[model samples]
Target: MTDTQDELPQLMSHQSFREQAREVIRGMIVSGKMAPDALYSAPKIASDLNVSATPVREALLDLVQEGLLRPVRNRGFQVVIMTAKEHDDVFKIRLLLEVPSIREIAKSSPTANQMKGLYDLANAARQFAREGDLIAYLNADRRFHISLIELLGNKPLTELVASLRDRVRLLGLANSGARSHIVQSATEHFELLDRIAASDTESAAAIIERHLRRSRDVWGAGSGPA
Candidate 1:
């Protein structure tokens, strides 16, 4: 066979590899293993993940489109690094979109089953945090917060909030060493649920806003852009 024919199998294998590589990188971003502003090398990632360079390149390209990574001048891609001002701006917008939506759900007075599910998610998140399982904690925490909006019946708002929440996850992982913050966050969820259960829209909204703001504050203090 010719040289081109010799390369065909490797090319075909790579074609099937990029999809899985993309997912692995996305998971690392979401789980905070790869932090914001951290530099990434395609070859290094490929070696680490036991794949070829082709898939790593494809995965990085996908992340760039998703706004999770960006190219650096004459170098590799870096995690999308947000400044403090940018983080604050996003946090404010998130509060505007999510707090009221959560309040509306609170006002609707969801069934016991609905509230129980959220509580269960919160409990699971707390356990994950206590165990120092960052990935599990991140997933469970996302579920706990998004569950409130999901209960509100706002699909569009939920999608938007989820995107913004992805950015916040970076900050959360940066400051994940703060045990108090984790405990406080878990406790706040219970309080927010209590307010929701009581159908106190005003208090519930206030609680959520405060919860998000405090999280931003704590994470921002240490993890803000350098």
Candidate 2:
């Protein structure tokens, strides 16, 4: 069968472009560039990012599936905003899941390659944080933490943790007052890796706890409940 003229539009559905659009849009949402409950149209987003609307729409639908966005009738997608109580509940659950998981992760003695990959991610996050690029920092930060959790060999758990991490409302993360704390936390990613490398499970768990609390207190600050 010969290709139809309609197939030209299909060019917009390229896998790499779709995935890139998805990640970029997701970063914008989670890094607090897209305010919660605000409606954003695919065309507007596409125009801003210099991409075709096709992949932008597809990306919006993907975020909707992730529960990060809600589709409005012929309008656009709204960022999903959680109540203060809901945010706190997610925070508590994250603490429960992540802190203990570090113990298991630390016992494994990650391969050198795994450690190197994580270090690269951690360094990227720190560098971005220092550069005041919240979006880039968030992407690297998510990967670094998720990589450590994956060492436990539990895909389900890793996905759950990642979803919860993304669900958080980081309202004040970009504030000047929060920059120091952000950098400190970014630096501590290395400390967490070190503790895990040394098999100091308790120490690693402590670092994880402190990290989560800062996330809850600093980034999530003014996001709702005190």
Candidate 3:
């Protein structure tokens, strides 16, 4: 190791460093600061994060297992690239899983506080869209939709949805070049919230499905495998 590498935090038996490193790297990838297909060098990452390369290497391995990154033969890791079919498959599963959960929440008639929280998140997403903050908008959008499903009180289902969401974030960030897309998403969010607040489970489910479909369509049109 170089002198700089020697200065990094010593890797103890604890696992928190690896977890924190994974989150940091994942955030960079999700936020578009780290381009897809770019090589991930442990030394560079350690230098940038001011940590030992061991945690960065461990985190990269974890991401690879999670399908977020892939190891190249005789080279460093690279961010995973998704085909259009993969993207469609992901969204299809999301619709199948998440739509029903949201419907359940609507049917259960969530408390006023719950509904308010969802609407507040939607409003924040819209504000981010209006300001052209794609990262904030995407994060808030995920929070709103995921929170809706979380209210259904299914731990396994929520875990599955969260896993799918990581993949969705990749596609959303890739398609952030189009401004109109954000506007359309914001409109859909408002409509969904309105339907939910009215306690219309059927309409809320339909609207949520439509939103996911439209998102797939728009993202497919913008960036997909050839």
Candidate 4:
């Protein structure tokens, strides 16, 4: 009898807008435009994104569920950053899951079309990095890595890896002054693909191992551990 909007949430027609707002805000947080120390209001974010407040509210609530943010009652939400130990643990888990798995991709018969698409994403990622657009860079980088993981044909594995990636808190990447490191990291994508194409499994694995390490060691460099 209490199945009203008062007792349960509803998914209305504005789902796409909510998703858009969520992705944009998430990108901002991940890119370091929104610091963990600050509180952000849905109305304010909607104003900045030029959207209605309702969708932004829904998006903000979603982020709360994902643990990227904490609700601040009437004020808004505060960004949540992972502890150094948590970040380090996530990095170790990713290393275990991603590095060796790359060998399977290198051994598989990936189509030329697939490789071309990945190369395009790699180039886009590189350009985004060079321009210092951390949001765009992370977007492209996420897609590149996820796409590579998808080639393994394991949906659960793909989802697990993606979830792990999402667990990373924003490390203020935009102001990290990691210009040289990011550029070098972006270029590593191409090297990964090249190794995959050559069927050099061990080499691909090594590249990815180093690549994964840098996220914990260098992506947020000059900050605290991990």
Best by TM-score: 2
Q: Ranking under lDDT, best-scoring first?
A: 2, 4, 1, 3
Candidate RMSDs in Å, in order, are 8.0, 6.9, 5.8, 7.6
List lDDT for all candidates, in order.
0.74, 0.78, 0.73, 0.77
Alpha carbon lDDT at 27, candidate 4: 70
Runs in model 4 deviating more than 4 A are: 1-15, 174-176, 222-226
Question: How would you encode candidate 4's per-residue C-alpha lDDT over 22-60 as one tens digit per residue?
Answer: 776777666666778887888877766666899989999
Candidate 1 residue runs with Cα over 4 Å from true position? 1-27, 30-32, 35-38, 41-65, 71-76, 171-177, 223-226
Residues 178-226, candidate 3: write the lDDT tens digits. Answer: 4677767887988987887788999999998888877767653666475
Among all windows of 10 consecutive residues in model 2, the one with the lowest summed lDDT is 1-10
What's the TM-score of each model vs. the native?
0.74, 0.88, 0.75, 0.85
lDDT leader: 2
TM-score-based ranking: 2, 4, 3, 1
Tens digit of per-residue lDDT, candidate 1, span 1-226: 1212221122235346786676556656755567565677888777776667987898899878777789887688888877777777888899889888887888899999998898999899889778765555666787788887888677888877877887765544445445677777888888999999999999999999998888777654676565
Supply the TM-score for candidate 1. 0.74
**Over 4 Å off, model 3:** 1-33, 42-62, 72-75, 169-177, 220-222
- Shift of residue 160 alpha carbon in model 2, Å: 0.6
| Candidate 2 lDDT by residue in tens digits, 1-226 | 0121121122244456677777777777776667765778888777666678898899889988877889999989888867777788889999999999998788878888888898889999999889977667777788888888998889999999988888885343546545687689799999999998898989999999999997887655665444
List the pairs of residues colliding in candidate 4.
none
- Residue pairs whose backbone atoms clash in candidate 3: none
